[model samples]
Target chain A: MTHLVSIENVDMRYGGASGTLAVAGLTFKVDKGEFAAVVGPSGCGKSTLMRLVTGLHIPQAGHVIVAGQHVTEPVSIVGMAFQNPSMLPWRTTLDNILLPLEIVERHRKRLRAHKAEYVEKAEHLLDVVGLKGFGSKYPWQLSGGMQQRANLCRALIHEPQLLMLDEPFGALDAFTREELWCVIRDLHAAQDVTIVLVTHDLREAVFLADKVLVMSARPGRVLREHRVPFARPRDLEITYDKAFNDVVHQLHGEIASARRAA
Target chain B: MSAVIEDIQKSEPARPLIARIDWVRASPWLYTIALFAIWEASVRFFDLPYTVLPAPSRIFAAFYQYWSPIWKNSLQTLYTTTLGFLMAVVGGLALGLFIGWSKVIYAGLYPLMIGFNAVPKVAVVPILVIWFGIGAIPAMLTAFLISFFPIVVNVATGLATIEPETEDVLRALGARKLDIMLKVGIPRSMPYFFGSLKVAITLAFVGSVVSETVASNYGLGNLMSSAQSQFNVPLVFAGLLALAVEGIVMYSIMAWVERRMTGWAHRSTMSH
Candidate 1:
C-alpha cells in the first residue's frame, strides 16, 4: 500500500524557542484512499498534527511529506473543515462553495470562462450533502446543521485528494452528529480520496475510520494504533453490537490512561 | 423544523404595509412640528422681543424677505461641504487601506492620526485662511480635515477584524495576501465604510460653517454673523433654519446610501 501522507519524528512548538511544545517525536502515515482517525485526551496535539500535515505550520524537527512532496508551505491539494463553519455572511451558499475555485490557481484561471460548469459542480455537491435548492440562500439563513452541510460541500467542491477534518461534528447534537456520520461514510465510500479525522469521540473513531491511532496527552505522540475490523457500509445499528462496544470501551480505556499520565 | 419555521413566521409582520402606522418614521417630523408650535405659542404669549427670540412665524417671514441672499449663501455652503466630503471619502479610504495593510504601518501611523484628529479643527480654520486667503477653499479644506477621521477609523477597524478562521480557509488554499484582501478584506469593510459616511457628512457641514464664520465672505455662517451685527435677529434665525434643513437633508441622503449599499450587514428586523 502506498502512503499519501507521511510524518516522521515531527516536533512542533508554538511561539519561539521558549514556547510551549505541542507535539514531540510524532510519527504517522496515512495510506492512499484510507479513512484514518486520530483520538486522544482533550489537550492532545491532534489539531497541531492536522496543521503540520496541511503545511499551515512547520515542525521544528523531522519531515512532513504529502503527495510525494515536502510540505514547507500551505499545500493546495487538501480540503479542511473545522468545528466552526465560519461561513462568510456576505456570500450565498453557492458562492461560498466556489471560493476555493476563485483562489486555487489551477481553477481560478479557468473559472471565469467555464463559470456554468463550476456552478453545476457546486450544485451537485450541495445536493449530495442534502442541501439541494439551498444554493441561493445566505449562510446565516441556514440552521447550524444545514450550514455544516454547506461547509462539507465547500470542502469537497475543489475535489481535493486529501480531506482534513478537525472535529467537524464536535459542535452538533448527538442525533445530528450521527446523521452526519452517515453522510461522511457515504461520501468516503463514493470518493476516491484520503481522509484524516481528528476527533475525541471513541465510537465515532471506531465507526467511521479504517484505522484508529491513539495519542498521549499534551506534547502528544502516537501511543498505539488499532485496525478497525468492521466491514464497510457499516450501519449505525452496529454501535449497539457487543463487539463494537468492546472496541469503543478499549479505546476509551486507552484515552483515560493517557489523560492520567499527563 | 416546523416549530422553527413557525417561530420565524410569527416574528414577521402580518399586516399589510399601508394598514400599519410607521410611528418610528413619522416621530421625527411630529416632534419638530410640536417644538415649533410650542416656541410660537410661548413667544406670542410673552410678547417677547424679536431680537431676543423670534417666533417661528417671524423667522419664516424673514426667510421670505431675505430669500435671495439666503438662497445664494445656502448654495455656497452646500457646495463647499459636498466638495470637501467627496475628497475625504477618497483620501480616507486610501489611507485606511494603507494603514490596515500591514502591522508596521498601522502602528507607525495610528497614533499620529489620533493626534491630528485631536487638535480643534475650528482653530485650524484661521491657519487655513492665512494660507488660502479667505474664500471657499478654507471652508472646503476644513470640512475635509474634520470629516475624514471617522471614515479612516471605521475602515481600518473593519479590515483589522477579519475572522482568523476565514483567513485560514483562504490561506490553506495557497491564496496570496492580495487575494485575501480582495476576496474578503475589502468586502468585509464595506458596511463599516458606508456607516462612517453618515457621520462624516454631518461633520463636514460643521467644518464648512465654522470656517465660513471666521474666514469666508459667503455661506450661512457669514450671513448669520452679519445679520447679528445689525440686530437683524429674524434673519439670523432664518440662517439657522437654513443650516438645520441642509444638515438634515445631507444626513438623510447619507443614511439612504448606507442602506442601499450594505443591506447585507443588517439583520432582517433592523433592515425593515
Candidate 2:
C-alpha cells in the first residue's frame, strides 16, 4: 500500500516559545485505505497530531504531507467527526448530514438542481447507520447515539479521501461504543477510505484498526507500532480470544510505562 | 412469551385527559384572574374612592366608556413600536454581525456600546422631541435607540461564541470565513436574536411610552398622563391595563418564535 499521510519529525508548541511543548519529533505514516488508530494516555497530544494532519495548525518544525501534497492550509480532502456530535441545532438530521455537501465546491453548485437526489443519498446513509425515518427529526429529538450516527453520516457525505475521528466514541456508553465500532468497521471496508482514529480505548483500537500506533505522554512521540494479525470482517466474538487480549495487554503495559517516564 | 404477556398486563391504564394536561402551561392566565379578583374584592370592601384606587369593575367601565379613543391610541402605539423595532432589527443585525465577525471589532466596540446603553433612553427622549418636534418620529427614534442595544449585544455574543470544536470541523473542511459565517454563524445566532427580540420588544414599548408621555399627541402613554393630570385615576388605570396587555402580547409572540426557531439548541441532549 502507498502512504496517504506522512508526518516527519514534527515539533509543536502551544502559546509561544516559553510555553508548553505539546508534541516532539512525532513521526508516523498511514498507508492508503488503511485503518490506523493512535492510542495514548490522556493529554498525550494525540489531538494536536490530528490538528497537524488536518492542516488546522502548521507544525513549528517538519512537514505534514497528505495525499502527496505538503499541507500548508486546511485540507479539503478530509472529513472529521469529534467526540461531541456538534450537530447544528436549527437543522434536522438530514439537513445536518447535507451540510458538507452544501459547503464543498463541486456539490454546492449542483445542490440546488439535484437536491432530491442528494436527499435520497443522505437518507440512505442514515439507514446504513440505523437512523432511517429519523431524517425529519431535529437534533434535540434524537438520542445521543442517534445524533453521533447522524454526525458520522455528515462527515462521510462529501466522500473525501480521508476520514479523521478524534475520540469519536469517547463520549458514548460501552454498549453504544461497541455497536458504533462495528458500524465504523463496516464503513471503512465499504468506502475504502483511509482512517486515522485518535482514541484512548485499547479494546477499540485492537478491534477496529489494522495497525495500532502507541504515543507517549506529553511532548508525545510514536512509542510503538503494532500490526494487528486479525483478518477482515472482525467479529465482536474475536475480542474474547486470547490473542486479542494479549495484544491489548502488551499495549496496556507500554502506556503504563510511557506514563511512568512522563 | 408468558413473561412478555405478564409485563403487558401489568402496565397502568392511560391517564385521564384533564389529568394529563400540563397545569404549568395555564398557570399564567389563572394567576392573572386570581389577582384581578382579589383587587376587585379589596377595593369594594374598603369602599375607596375611584380617585384613590379604582376597582377592576370601575376600570373596565372606564375602558368601555372611552373604547374608541383607547383603541385608536393603542393601535397608534403598536404601529410606532413595530416600525421602530423593525428598524432596530435591521441595524442591530448588521452592526452585530460586523462586531462579531472579528475579535478586534468586538473588543474595540464593546465598551463603547455599554457606555451608550448606560445613558438612560428616557433622558434622550426630550432631545429627540426637540430635534424632530412632538410626534411619532421622536417616539419611533426613542424605541430604536433603546431597543437596538440588546440585539447587537446578543447577536454579537452568539457569533463570537461559536464552539471551537465546530469551527475546527468547518475549518478543516477548507471552508472560507464567509462560508462559515453564512452557513453557521447566522443560523446559530438565530436563537440569540429571538431571545434578544423578546427583551428588545419590551424595551421598545418603554421607549415609545416614555417619548409619548413627554412629547407625542397620541398613544396610551399620552392618554395616561392626561388622565393623571385630570385625576381620572380609573382612566389612567385603564391605560395601564391596555399597555400591560400589549406588552404581554408582544412578549408572548417573540417567545413563541424563539421556541419555533431554536428548540433544537435548548432541548438537544448534551450527553455527547
User: What is the lDDT, from 0 to 100, of the residue A162 in candidate 2?
Assistant: 93
Q: Write the per-residue lDDT of candidate 2 for residues A1-262, one digit (tens) a residue.
A: 6799999999999999988999999999999999999998888999998899999999999989999999999887899999999888878889889989877787899999999999999999999888999999888788778889999999899888899999898888999999999999999988879999999899999999999999999999999999999999999999999999999999999999999998
**Candidate 2, B36-133: lDDT as tens digits:** 99999999999999999999999999999989989999999998898899999999999999999999999999999999999998899888878999
TM-score of predicted structure 2: 0.90
TM-score of chain A by itself in each prediction: 0.99, 0.98
True lDDT of residue A61, candidate 2? 94
Instruction: Give the CA lDDT, 0 to 100, for residue B15 in model 1.
Output: 64
* lDDT of candidate 1 over A1-262, digit per residue (tens): 8899999999999999999999999999999999999999987999898889888998999999999999999998999899899887789999999999999989999999999999999999988888999999988888788889999888888899999999999999999999999989999999998999999888999999999999999899999999999998999999999999999999999999999999
Clashing pairs in 2: none
lDDT of 2: 0.91
Model 1 lDDT at residue A147: 85
CA deviation > 4 Å runs, candidate 1: B1-22, B42-48, B268-272
